[model samples]
Target: MTLYARYSELLDTVLDTLQADGTLPDGIERRAVAVEPPRDPAHGDLATNAAMVLAKQARTNPRALAEAIAPGLEALPDVSSVEIAGPGFINLRLTDDAWRGELATILREGDSYGRSDAGGNERVNIEYVSANPTGPLHLGHCRGAVVGDALARVLEAAGFRVTKEYYVNDAGGQVDTLARSVHLRYREALGADIGEIPEGMYPGDYLVPIGTSLAAEFGDEYAEAPESEWLELFRTRAVAAMLDFIRHDLATLGIHHDVFASEAALQAEGAVDAGLERLRSKGLIYEGVLEAPKGQTPEDWEPVELTLFKSTEFGDDQDRPMKKSDGSWTYFGSDAAYHLRKAESADHLVNIWGADHAGTVKRVQSAVKALTDGRVDLDVKLVQMVRLFRAGEPVKMSKRGGTFVTLADMVEEVGKDVVRFIMLTRRADAPLDFDFAKVVEASKDNPVFYVQYAHARVRSLVRKAADAGVSLDAPADLSLLDAEELALVKLAAQYPRTVESAAMAHEPHRIAFYLYDLAAAFHALWNRGNDDPGRRFLVDDNPELSRARLELALGIGQIIRSGLDLMGVEAAEEMR
Candidate 1:
């Protein structure tokens, strides 16, 4: 029922014909061959990379291979023409009927048009926005969270078994600092006048709830104890409180993770030790000293011996230390083991990280390679900065003094839907500018509102059509649809193919852009009707044309619904 996907079957048929006709070399691998939209629309509706991919292995000129592939394709029903352009790309132009038939499929499949099985139920783990438990998530974490969540949704739509995960940095110096901050709050909760927060203590008032709860539960007993007595327990309580607040903030944007892996748990059962031993068996662990890292050489850059992981054995610039001189594991040490643990259960691993950790990419990937010995694929997506704005003015930050905005604060101001949709309007690696004023406007400039408006418009069209007594026969004549009506139908048919591409490329922003384009096309068609009375969705005494156009509009509406669902944006039947 998926129009674009069905063409892939036709593509397979062409390959089979080539093999059977003895035109192509024997033992051709079909898996490497792909069908996609040509970058230049003038080339064709779709282009395949098969010719170039098979050229080296088959020992044949790519153009000749493309020539052989074209004849087989030209014989297909939907393929109007197949041309070999520049190198060996095979371009296919579908017939008008072929494009028109896509609308039929949209009505049949509804919102599920673009779902693909490219993943074949394989297990995929996506770790993202593993922000520290120290404070509320802010604009820094927003883009990665939206990107990761949307990517998981797209992958699942493509038939992959995806697990959304959050790695909590609970057992670390940050958490210890968090404990000290709460101890201050605990003292304040007992009505003590705590002076200005110490230089090293966390200054956020977020931990006040933890203190108030402690006083209510354990009473003055724990309050009277020394710092050591309540620090760990308070740290645990504060982290739980922080996580709950974080999860609630994420839910506002409809984000959810299947797993919440704690770094402490990896250390609890000696999993970190076990992971290091596995690397040791592979001759990838040793005790040594590392050279000074890039940029500033720490004043304490004395060449000191420590147990180091042989990340250099894979691709790291230098051996990285697993333990500092004092015997405590460094952040990189826990991260290496964490990835190893993930690699064990996934066919593929994807981690979404903040821009600040760009340097950590090589070490984590190296550890993953060491653990899986290159069997598992690991991809780390680094998110660039977000330039938060409101009506063209830059938003300032330094929220420790209340200068910046928190994630919850943004959601509270703009609402969750606007915040999520605007975040995805740009790629994760590219810098994104989120404007609070622009995103919530009802005008066409707001992509989120524009796309949602298309849905609401279509929904209203369907209800009006029914009220006008339009009845669709058992099988309407699709060929009778006008050119404008047919064009909208063709757009509806491409939903499935778009989903497949977005997932395969690991690009969720593509979905956002695609939905905007689809919405634009549909809206343009609607406005055309308004400009020409005869072509309007509701024409006077032209029941047949109106019925035909209504069906086309319905198909477009269904596709818009499907695309918005994939992007985790609501397909509003009506907008506020």
Candidate 2:
């Protein structure tokens, strides 16, 4: 158990005791009670709202309830003091030995220190970076990819069976456009001087290789044939080739999905029909005409009777169309079918989509709820766009990708670690500026560098300690660590709690944010050592103190490495 969790259990025992002894009434809901470090460190090591949450149920004022509860907490081992302050909030102060023992726990657990079973091994299917196979992945997909991948890692660490998934929209019209685009490139490869790509066609040169390969394989067989003869053939081959390209791009960023659910395959198996039938059995599927969209002129809006799903019954703003008047499945219909397929295998489903799809979230969620009969839940995380910049100027589009900077270009320009780390420096729904110059800058302002530097400095310190004849295997007295060093240990001890909360919240960015703060704290301690030699981690004249401090430094390094691993980033031993 984490330090916070241990205290939380003890706090729960205290509350239970209060009820059993008649100091507080029974059957009070303690779910709202939380045990966490105080907002200001000066106040306490840990704080709980047990008294505040239970006072009304106990038929007593919060302050009186807190006073009745304080005695139980004060009796716990390692809890040196417990103070009730400000409207009955209980603040706890533990002995310095508690923080030192946490550091020892860090070293003992090492890389596995923050692992938790909070998820109870529930199955989670996370679909992310499901970009169309028409082109290379862009910066927008990059952000979602990192966020999704990192969340999967965090969830796994928190004991969830997570399936990293990608949905291929190959059944859409976009792939047909891709076929026409590839055909143009094929014709050009076969010696046609195709100048200036058409406005509606993809103009990127990345398709040139696919066309050249097709020309070599089939010669002129489909070159002069009609569109019908080669459209399916080209679409199949082009999507496959583009998928290869996308896989390579994702590999550069260290992303690999365990499952790639294809829309074409789903339709081929009649999943859409089956999904709609399931909803129909529940009376959710109906044929109706939707009212004209908001602000539409009555004459301009011609309502057509379409097959619809009663999404509003499940909390959507309106019923969603499952099929067009001509019987073609709507995007929502196929998407809902895909979700049903996932929910069949997984206990929960999560979709990481661009912010542009925000309006569609509710309908998809409703579909999942209706399809699963509330047995499963769908969590859609919308990631906003990323703006690329060089220094302070906006970066231009990629010639190879045609419209925007490709994920490959960004990964190649900087590195996989930098790309992954910086992409998660903000919340998924917030706009991120991928400043090429700023991310690579070796300064505190750059979170990637700052966090990596903290790890690297610890490595350098260890090497320097070894070179100075300090015995690394020596068991040191942890009591030698001072208040500032113990404070860093306190910060490091929160990793497990952070992992649990981040996993439960489905927010991997919390890990990144926590890592940066931990790094900042470590860096602040390092800076202090420069001014006071006695405070330095390596004290050449005092080997005993150095060994104790070395233990502290190594514990910090272990946390940095573990946290970076969760983010799919490397703990750098040396920075260039």
Candidate 3:
């Protein structure tokens, strides 16, 4: 059993014994009893407020309960001391052997040391990068993609059955515009000038390659065909190429979606019609004129009666139109069906959207409630904008043609590891300033380098041990590890708990910060060795102690690797 598990069990015995002795009531809730490291590390190793929490319920003073509980805990197997602090805060000091116990557990479990079943085997579908297929994904999509992918991996690590999905917006007028753009590109491919890309045509040079490929296939035939005969054909090929490009872009970041759900396909079998009919049966679908939108209502505001859904019933600000006056399905209509399809497949749906889509949150949430009859929850995580920098100046990237930065460009410039890590350095809702020059720096200010250096030091120690002819077989003579090394081990062991909490909160940046702390702990211990010779990891003459220290180093190295793996960062073995 883990040291934490044993500690929890011993604490339980104390609580139960206290209840039996009438120091506290028997029917108190035990869920809030959390044993975690104290905010001020000097106070103790671990702290809990069990007595304080139960005081109100038991109608007794917390200090009295903690005093009664302390003796029961002090008698346990690994107990060093149990002290009742201010207002019944129980601070427990474990035997040095308990610290040794943490190191031993790390050596035994390695990468899986911090793994937990905290997710309760629930299924979650994380949908992200639902960007339009109009063009290649710009820099903005990159942040959401990394955040969502990392969160999905974290949830999986925490034992949730996670499905990483991408919703394709293939049915909209945007695709039609893309088709027309490709048609223009088709004409240009057949040796036409195309004349300044026209007013509305997509002007990206990337489409030149698609047009060239299409020309090679059709050989001037599509250029001569009418819009009706060639629109669908070019649209299909163009979207496929766009999707292929997007897929390759995601692959560069080590992200792969388990499902690529098509919004158009949801309407192939009249599913949208059937879904709206269902809403109609439930009295949600109605014909009404929407109140003019605030601030920007047109002067020609004719109250045209259109079919609407009473989204306000499910907490939306106003009723929404599912179909426009032309009887074409609106964007929200397809989204509602898509969410319904998602509800049919997964236990829950989570969407990662950009800040611009923030206002759409309530309507989509309301639609999901109406579609599922409040059976499924649609949680939308709004990721704010990301600004880029290079050489300490802003790197301006416009969304227009020839001005934008592709996800590939950023990844190519600084590499995927640096790109992914920097993107996750801030919370999704917060703005991130990513400076390429600052990220690759080798100093302590660069968190990426600092964290990787911690791992490399461990690797160096492991190499030194092998060179010194020490056997790594014995489960790490952890008793030789001092206070600093023990603290590092304990911090590393909290990774699984950190990931569980981060995933539960829809926050991937937490893992980024956790790595920083873990790295800081390792750095602190490394710096300690400089001031104290006995604390150094290598002792050439004392081979036994050297082996145990090597084991601790290897344990730290393993944690660095595991943590880096989760964040999709590279764990550098040696920083040259």
Which 10-residue span in candidate 2 carries the lowest summed lDDT?
396-405
Candidate 1 Cα outliers beyond 4 Å, as residue runs: 49-60, 86-88, 293-299
lDDT of each: 0.82, 0.92, 0.83
For 465-545, candidate 1 gives per-residue lDDT tens digits of 778887676555667687766656655666777787888788888888988888998888889866689877767687777
The TM-score, computed over Cα atoms with residue i paired to residue i, of candidate 2 is 0.97
Q: List the residue pairs that clash in candidate 2.
A: none
| Order by lDDT, highest first | 2, 3, 1
How many clashes show up in model 1?
A: 1
| Candidate 2 lDDT, 77-144, residue by residue in tens | 89999999999999999999999899989999887899988889999999999999999998889999
Question: Which candidate achieves the best TM-score against the true structure?
Answer: 2
* After superposition, candidate 3 runs with Cα above 4 Å error: 1-6, 9-28, 59-69, 295-297, 531-534
lDDT of 1: 0.82
Superposed Cα RMSD, model 3: 2.4
Q: What are the TM-scores, per candidate, against the unseen true structure? A: 0.94, 0.97, 0.93
